[model samples]
Target: MMTRLKIGACLTLDTLPDHRDWIFEADRDLELQDFLSHAALTTDRDVLIERARQALDGFRGKLSIHGPFEGLDIDNKDPELRPVITARFLSALEVADRIGARKMVVHSPYTLWYQNNLHSYPGYAETKLARIHDVLGPVLRRAEELGITLVIENIQDVRPETRRAMVDSFGSDAMALSIDTGHAQLARRMSGAPPVEDFVRDAGAQLAHVHLQDVDGHADRHWAPGEGEIEWSAVFRAIAECEAPPHLVLELRDATHIPAGFAYLRDRGLAV
Candidate 1:
């Protein structure tokens, strides 16, 4: 029998206060502050490595790492902020290397400016393009040398052209795409963004990872497969048709949801 697609949780090892505010209510006993601090400190790398290994035990699926999403900026214009981003990525890399993970997911710096702005100004696209090259150039180059794959994700209607542009600029097999399903849904609903299949195809040779989640037309719900209205069968079909099957990560909030999601994929004959 063919194996199932990998299902993994996003570790909010160092989330921002605003995001953690909701997580507290979702998982009351998680001790968010302590976990974040522990993940931030490298003295505990072995412990973190074991935790990830344990998390994947008995599972015959590939593993991938989601680096610190909160307060991480690969495209920061300030020289001071670059090291902070690099350190966070390196920490995640250490854990991933320990667990034999093949891909590390990182977001562009769009969230920093797009959070408050309601309008899409003229020069915004050009500005973000320049920022992406400046911020991710060194990091992507180093990732190539280190044999680590860095997959850049799209957020808030980041144009497909821009995504293609960034990957072409890097021109390295180590650099690729991480397509977030919910984010793509949100972009389609809110901004009339192009279809998910189109994005995947456009990404072409650089598409290396995927984040699967279900959401309504509004906020990201992160619901289990078949629990929400997403057309998962279509999504999987698109993935199957890709030139290469990128790593498919469930990106669920909880581990409890993983079994059901796996079952759903199995029932659809997509486990392989």
Candidate 2:
């Protein structure tokens, strides 16, 4: 039977092994902030594209690109820095296009620092959200034009509602949620937020992508699904109940865990 969801593993330079049958989530390695700082595009761009093609060769499966998210911030308060950020994002979208990627994963602009200082500035959240919308608008339009779905993953988002509200405000079909199970578990332990299953349920229809890793509830361990204390059964069930199923990627810390993670999901009848 063909599952409604697609399953894959996160492929870095080191893990581009014999994954010919599974889908892939390719990570962009070029640090765009550095490129933007140096104003050098030709050599680096050529190398990035060549390496991406080599890494993706012989893979007959769907592809998604993990957009550059190291030092770039879409919600940066600095006016001058916003353009640089947007330009770097545009570069990432270009890479996605070259690779024929169907979707891209971007980290949410919200952070735990904002939540901690929520009371300091009464309208800070609104201001940050507005800036994020403005910064991401062009990138989202480009993704839509390229037939790509830009999935926003939660990093420091303690409350899924805040992220959901931000995504809903755009009202664009090109943008959607990419839930990271390990991050959610860590947030629940560190900030008293909801658990992993609750996040999946809350995301519901908005969920379009997922990092199906597990954690010990204290830190982002990024272990295989069944190796940690997370309730895999409950999480998968919540996902199954969603109106739109999401692409499930085994974002394990170690590549060796990939086979075990797939087996664990298969045993539970949640291969996708």
Candidate 3:
């Protein structure tokens, strides 16, 4: 049996717009119950486990998961908010455990605005990171107990130095790098840092997961592979050269685009 690369989508159950737009829309519609209703109707733990089994039934591939993206803040500074985030993280891990997913992706929860606006705050990044470590430490310990891998992704304009700092602070192999292709593209465009491939190669030893998507040199629209402007072939080559290739998860915004993405990888002789 030929080995296939694990292809998974982010936990984007609803079609909400970008974060900024969502905040503005929410402010306008105070009575909007659509968000809660949508969440209530989507797959629960049991349902997700079954779905995972069904999705991977015949495919000779590894399994991974992208945890819920919305309304989760692992780096919240508020003491009252920490438990809620921790609970959600554990719940996500439960789903991963049920589905036999080896890796789960998580974000630091601080947006570009939060970082930029708080530049004057004392120990800004350190405080947030330490809070994150405190919140994630137990969750990761539990994941380790359950034999699950948690991969942290870099988002917004967070510098590579900060990324490395966050990862090192976590202090575990379970907490490794999850390179988001679109985010890397955005970083390169804005900062003129090394290309995405270079970042992946430099973090090769610590890479544990990847979020595959395309961006049109501006925003991360999560376009299907080859639809936007990412060099998919070069990415595959980089992964192939890694000491241990990270699990590649297709973080497309839409499920309908998954098949085409898989086909593109297949055409490149990369398992999917």
Candidate 4:
């Protein structure tokens, strides 16, 4: 049997012209923020919601949202900032429910700096993991209440074990994993992190979403899949073997590169 999966594109205003029949992960921008922030809910969000409804009126496919994580850390130990971060995540979750997003992609808090000095401080990882649970426990419960899957995406995670541990700790059906190929590649080349395949291999059945992009082995190039030096065959092979295929999202930097990305997958006989 051929490798079959629900392939999707990241939805940006510039790329909406090419968004026929493809599943989509809503892009983060001013519009999304307006809907996600409690402060902007009344005036700014009302207009954006109407516009979004009109724009997506004819679209027929599954939807996901990328939750806010720019400066928010679920593992933050600060007493004052912890509540603030929790509120932001709660807001994001509410927005996800309103938009009919079945899944929300959140960034992992594991960082390169922390990993580099992890050995010096014994049990630090465990403590941080506990903090993460404490902060996100309610959010995860709320997501479960809303029938949404909370997918944790690897950002600067040098190794998969820490993140895998955190996800396992949740023990909620609503909690899952996401793999960003470009971010994983950049972590490996720039920080001597594990190979990109390691993430898919470890995530296994827990994988629920993906950010499929090409990288030049150093920076987050986000080029078309075939335009960079990533080993595509191994990546696809790993994905094909998953117990349940994840949502493959073409999250390219430019809208113009999306067709080329789809073409690359087609040429490889991996298109769904």
Candidate 5:
């Protein structure tokens, strides 16, 4: 059986038109990245949101936005930081709501240190998890009310299961898991994490979205699918078992390479 999933693109207004025709499918997501810009989310908020709104005027495909994540840890322990982080997230979700997005991508905070030490340090897991729920609680309620799902994407995560556990704790449909192929590759190389393919199977049905990019396994190169060392076939095979029918987003560092990346998957009969 062919699990031919639709491939999508992560784009800014500047690159959206460049890849617009290629991203015409209704289920093929266009992950907007402009909102992730600090300036765009803060002082220039309306201007950039209007720019994005205008750029998406005629497109009817599913939409998802990369939420603002730079230093905005969802589970920050400092009480003072919680509201600040909460406010920033809600601010970004407003953009998501305005853009008619059903999904938003947020970064994960799991690390190898946490994975190894959470048990050793009593109440450590609870502290972080409580912080997460407290911070994300409002944003999640808004996301659910707006019919949006916040997919937790892996970054420096060496432990996918722990992240999954964290996602599961929310016990809400508005929360799910996301895997960044390039991030997984980097984690595998630097921290002895499982292979990128395993990350997919590990996320299983809760996997709501994916960021497809290739890396040299040394750094986040974010190259087109075939431009790096990733095994595309193995990755897609793993993706097929995901019951969420996860949104496969081509999140290249160079957005212009999207067509080539999509074709690489198509030529190999990996994605539809």
Candidate 6:
């Protein structure tokens, strides 16, 4: 049974071995989520990427990787701090490149705090973009060189246009947008951010990747799709309208529930 739109799952090495057959059964796309951690990126990175690359030898679908984001900011104000951030992202991109990933998902730098206090300083938005470029500039070049696109996933971004500008500032084909439905919904629920649907609509063709987890609109639930409050129909409708299309990944916390999530969307004719 072919999916209405191609969909995939975010998998860790632990789950990868068990699900490799399922992953190939229908040629589903894959997002390597484990490399987004410190343990997988440092000290043990070679062993990790080698194992994942070996296991995915026959995968026919597109590939992506989830880059590290914890405690790192792409737009760090300190010029001294920007290099460290850049190093971290470049390391993650190395993993993505080695694994032959088409895209790498990086966390957006925008925050609810930054958006709320836009008036606190002059040229806040412009400075933010400049800082981001200072850090991500080299990483972007490296990504383009490796034939990999960098997709910025929304975290505390209440203002989607700001994310748009950050992506636009690079003006490189390697830069694009990603939406984590759960995070967008949590921002809307907690701080009046735009709904998840709006994020999808705004990204339009430039939307290259998506983390398709369902949330309660209260927190980062990462639940199976049908269990959450998000309007799946509207979300998929907007996704269907995308001009560039995207890799839809079921990013559930429990890999066991991924089949359930895929079924939920498939039953509704949203995916396979």
Give each prediction's root-mean-square deviation over alpha carbons: 7.6, 4.3, 9.4, 3.6, 1.5, 1.8
TM-score of the candidate numbered 1?
A: 0.75
Tens-digit per-residue lDDT, 3-54, candidate 2: 4344677766445655534443333211111223223233476676676778
What range of 10 consecutive residues in model 4 has the weakest lDDT sum? 25-34
Off by over 4 Å in 4: 1-4, 21-43
Summarize candidate 4's per-residue lDDT along 115-203 as a digit string, tens digits.
Answer: 88888898987888888987898899899999999999998888877788789988988999999999998888888977788789988
lDDT by residue for model 5 over 71-186, one digit each (tens)? 89998879998999898998999999997888899999888888789789889988888999999999999998888999999999998898999999988999999999999999
Residue pairs in candidate 1 whose N, alpha carbon or C atoms collide under 3 angstroms: 4-271
Per-residue lDDT tens digits for candidate 6, residues 79-137, read: 88889889988999998888888899999988889888899999988888888889899
Error of 1 at 125 (Å): 4.3
Q: How would you order the candidates by lDDT, starting with the best? A: 5, 6, 4, 2, 3, 1
Reference-based lDDT, each prediction: 0.63, 0.76, 0.65, 0.76, 0.88, 0.88
Q: Estimate the TM-score of every prediction.
A: 0.75, 0.86, 0.75, 0.89, 0.95, 0.96
Residue-level lDDT of model 3, residues 74-187, one tens digit each, is: 777788888877777787777767656677777756455654667688777678777888788889998889888887787764455566667787677777887888888887
Error of 6 at 194 (Å): 2.2
Assess the local accuracy of residue 123 in candidate 1 as a C-alpha lDDT between 0 and 100.
Answer: 69
Cα error, candidate 2, residue 194 (Å): 0.7
Candidate 2 C-alpha error for residue 269, in Å:
2.8
- Candidate 2: which stretches are off by over 4 Å? 1-6, 21-42, 54-60
Q: Which of the numbered candidates is closest to the native, going by highest lDDT?
A: 5
The local lDDT score (0 to 100) that residue 113 gets in candidate 5 is 87
Each candidate's number of clashing pairs is 1, 0, 0, 0, 0, 1
Indicate the worst ten consecutive residues by lDDT in candidate 2.
Answer: 28-37
Off by over 4 Å in 3: 1-43, 50-60, 110-120, 191-193, 263-272
